[model samples]
Target: MSWDLSFMFDDLLPALLVGLQYTVLSTVLGYLIALLLGLLIAVVRRVRVVGPVAHGIMEFIRTTPLLIQLVFVFTLVPPTVTPLTVGVVVLGVHYAAYTAEVYRSGIEGVAKGQWEAARALSLPLRRTWGAIVLPQAIRKVIPALGNYLIAMFKDTPLLFAIGVTEMLMMAQRVGQPAGRVMEAYTLVGIMFLLVSIPSAILIRRLERRYAAV
Candidate 1:
């Protein structure tokens, strides 16, 4: 069948746009959780007694499939929680495993002299990290985090596995019953391209700008 430009722009676009809102919301909320939780995991992994355990958990989470994680959370959490909520939290925790490493690498990138300088100044441990370490580390890692946000944006389609009805699912809903697939699916792909491509370029520019620092 020939492409239906009118249907794509009219029917499919609205459904996909609604779905796109969910996609962006999940990506953003999920990434916010990832940033906070990942930082905590990174910090906790430095603890002498619990470090290895934390590292093991991080590895386990990293190695597992994200879809399985989402499904598992859906089953494990109380029924009162919506699938979208489960999807968001699972996405956050799943990526937190990866983001922790991002944070760890960022932390390692901080100069040893800086650590020594903090010691030399006799700053409290918390203050040393708060005032000196994290600010520098976070600056270096902002681009990396932006990349993950894009990754999360792409991954939002997976939320449909748990019935969350993100973009891909919306495309299928728009297309399947109508007995045509190309227009709706193509629009969804274009929607992703429109957002992701420019975002990727911006992140690359940011990475270069950060590197020049």
Candidate 2:
């Protein structure tokens, strides 16, 4: 049978938009959690006492599949917690391991002179990182972080595995009753392309901008 382009746009789009809302919400909130947690992991790993343990944990997280982590969290967490919340936390913590590596590279990329200069001034450790190291490191890593956000956006469909009713899940629900799976899934692919392509272009621009620094 021929594709129903009209139904794809008129009926399917709206429903998918609702799902997109959840997708966007999860990505944004989850990315924030990842950014912060990754920074924390990177910073903590610099410490003399707990560094090895933190390194081991980060390695473990990075080595595992995010799908496994998501399923594990969904099964292990109390039902009182919403599936969305579980999805967000799992996505965040999983990506945080990678982001931690991003952060570690960024932090390490800072010139040794900067750290020595901080010491030369007798600057407090907090001030050294807060004022000097992090600013430079974060600026350098913006492109990488944006790329991860885009990756997370595409990965939102995995939320379906946990019954989160995200975009792909919404598409399936809308299509199943009407037996319009082609229209539904086609639109979903279009939607993803629409968002991801522009985002990828923006990230490239960011990479150029940051690389110039």
TM-score for each prediction? Answer: 0.97, 0.97
Off by over 4 Å in 2: none
Candidate achieving the largest lDDT: 2
Question: Tens digit of lDDT per residue, candidate 2, span 1-213?
Answer: 988888888888999999999999999999999999999999999999988998998899888888888898899989898999999999999889989999999999999999999999999999999999999999999999999999999998999999998999999999989889988988889888999999999999999998976
lDDT of 1 at 4: 77
- Predictions: Cα RMSD each: 1.0, 1.0
Give the range where candidate 1 is weakest over 10 consecutive residues by summed lDDT. 1-10
lDDT per residue, candidate 1, 1-213, as tens digits?
A: 688788888888999999999999999999999999999999998899988999999999999999889988888988899998999999999999989999999999999999999999999999999999999999999899989999999999899999998899999998999876888878888999999999999999999999854
* Candidate 1 backbone overlaps, count: 0
